[model samples]
Target: MRTNLDFSPLFRSSIGFDRMLNALEAASRAETIDTWPPYDIAKTGENDYRIVMAVAGLSQDELAITQEQNMLIVAGQKANSDDVEYLHRGIAGRSFQRRFELADHVKVVGAGLVNGLLTIDLKREIPEEMKPRQIEIRTGQGMPKAETKQIEAKKQAA
Candidate 1:
């Protein structure tokens, strides 16, 4: 059973949160969740993250990773061979694509494939202007004095 949530109340009073609200609505509308090729997401540090995926029987050349804006896409294509016939096929060798939504300022630093496990590293780098800054407060004594100029009247009775 699927339940739909109404966000009309939030939309009326909120501002500049359309993207986050839209993401929530889309997630709720998804019918089936894909669980193939198990993966794990871990937080290595304050701004560092790692994603490990079990892509058995897939080589580096068969896998592709892409970063577009705030989305991370991972796709795998398995090459099929007809020369060998197997009576029992227990292993999965199929093409699959997965997408992950990334937050602002989050970027993928590196990726590697070893022993059928794909590892991807990510880091969140905030711009200097966007980071929190401290403001200095000054009292009246520290304020600069305003300059005043005196005007002389010209003698016209010569």
Candidate 2:
């Protein structure tokens, strides 16, 4: 089941949010997302996150992880081997590609495969210039010394 949302009104009112809105719209239109290799996203710290995917039969060489712009792509393809034969194959080893959208300033730290789980670590490193800072406010009782000098100069000129 898929639903298409009308985002024309939002597009008209919002600015610099095209990517986010487009992602949302795409997600809505997608009826069935690949869930073969189950994954979990966990927040490990204030600005740290980890994504763990169950890749039971995939080796390090069979999986590839890449980040392009603001998107992270994880793809896996099982290598062909004719040595094994099974009457009933239960564990899935199908090729799949998964995508994840990352916010601004978010970066990939590292990735590791332990047991059968592939763990991807991420950290949000906001630049010093982009971080929020407190602005000094002025009260009614006292003006800044620099402002007082400017006022005095204006009076003298008058």
Candidate 3:
């Protein structure tokens, strides 16, 4: 006997979960989205990681880093004046949004801007019990039956 897995009818069912379905639909749409703001992710040490974003011309006052709902969102806006005239504006001093996928254990420690590089450090401190350990075993076997009695006898004998 053979069973046929028919998923076609399941797709036709109208559960009417429009919002949830829409959000999931948008998830697929997000797969094609990519923003080019060069960045470097480096693991400096055990449980320590750093994210360096190249945000030239963006001051510390202009940048904001926040964690919301498991997303590390780095957003910044260049301080501007509408009345300023630019004879030759080549450098990009515009707004930017950068998103990072953070693991469950990973967390943002702090952030700083140095030499046009915005560095955000993350750490994942696992508990002591969570760390791997070797289990030490003692098995002189059932206490070596005869040997056990001999030691007790020796203590008494002495």
Candidate 4:
């Protein structure tokens, strides 16, 4: 079951928040989806993150990891184990696929599997042009008014 949410009320007051609203809507809709192969997302550093998933009974070959733009996908399909018979199967050997939405400039740095756990490392690499930079405010005493005006004019022309 799904419910329709009227976002018009929220949209009327917010400016330049369309992307954020869309992201929120997507997350709300995903709540009804499956959560197989439990996973945890954690922040390790200032701009670093890690996603750990419990994927027992799966090898590196059985799992696949892919990233398309801002989406990260991890899938696993267990091989045929019909040869081994078990009276009662407790461990889950089923296949599952998980997706994660990464923020801008966030990238998957590496991935590894150890002790039935899959760990994926991520880092947000903001470009130099995008990173916050401090502007050096110039004081009038440093230069004469004429030079400052000429510099301003040159900058305007450029």
lDDT of each: 0.95, 0.91, 0.79, 0.89
TM-score of 3: 0.63
lDDT of each residue in 102-152, candidate 3, tens digit only: 665678999999999999999987778888999778689745466444344
Using TM-score as the measure, name the better of candidate 1 and candidate 2: 1
Show the lowest summed lDDT stretch of 10 residues, model 4. Answer: 147-156
lDDT of 2 by residue, 1-158 (tens): 44578998999999999988998888888877777789999999999999999999999999999999899999999998779898988988789999999998889999999898999999999999988999988797787565444344444653
The regions of model 2 sitting more than 4 angstroms off are: 138-158
Error of 1 at 41 (Å): 0.7
Best by lDDT: 1
Query: In candidate 4, what are the lDDT values of residues 1-158, reduced to their tens digit?
Result: 67867676778999987777888877766666687899999999999999999998899999999999989999999998678989998989898889888888999999999999999999999999998999888888885566434344344553
Which pairs clash in model 2?
A: none
Residues 37-79 of candidate 1 have per-residue lDDT tens digits of 8999999999999999999999999999999999999999999
Sort the predicted structures by TM-score, highest score first.
Answer: 1, 2, 4, 3
Structural RMSD, model 2: 5.0
Sort the candidates on lDDT, descending order: 1, 2, 4, 3
User: By summed lDDT, which 10 consecutive residues of candidate 3 come out lowest?
Assistant: 1-10
Between candidates 2 and 3, the one scoring higher on TM-score is 2
Model 4's number of clashes is: 0
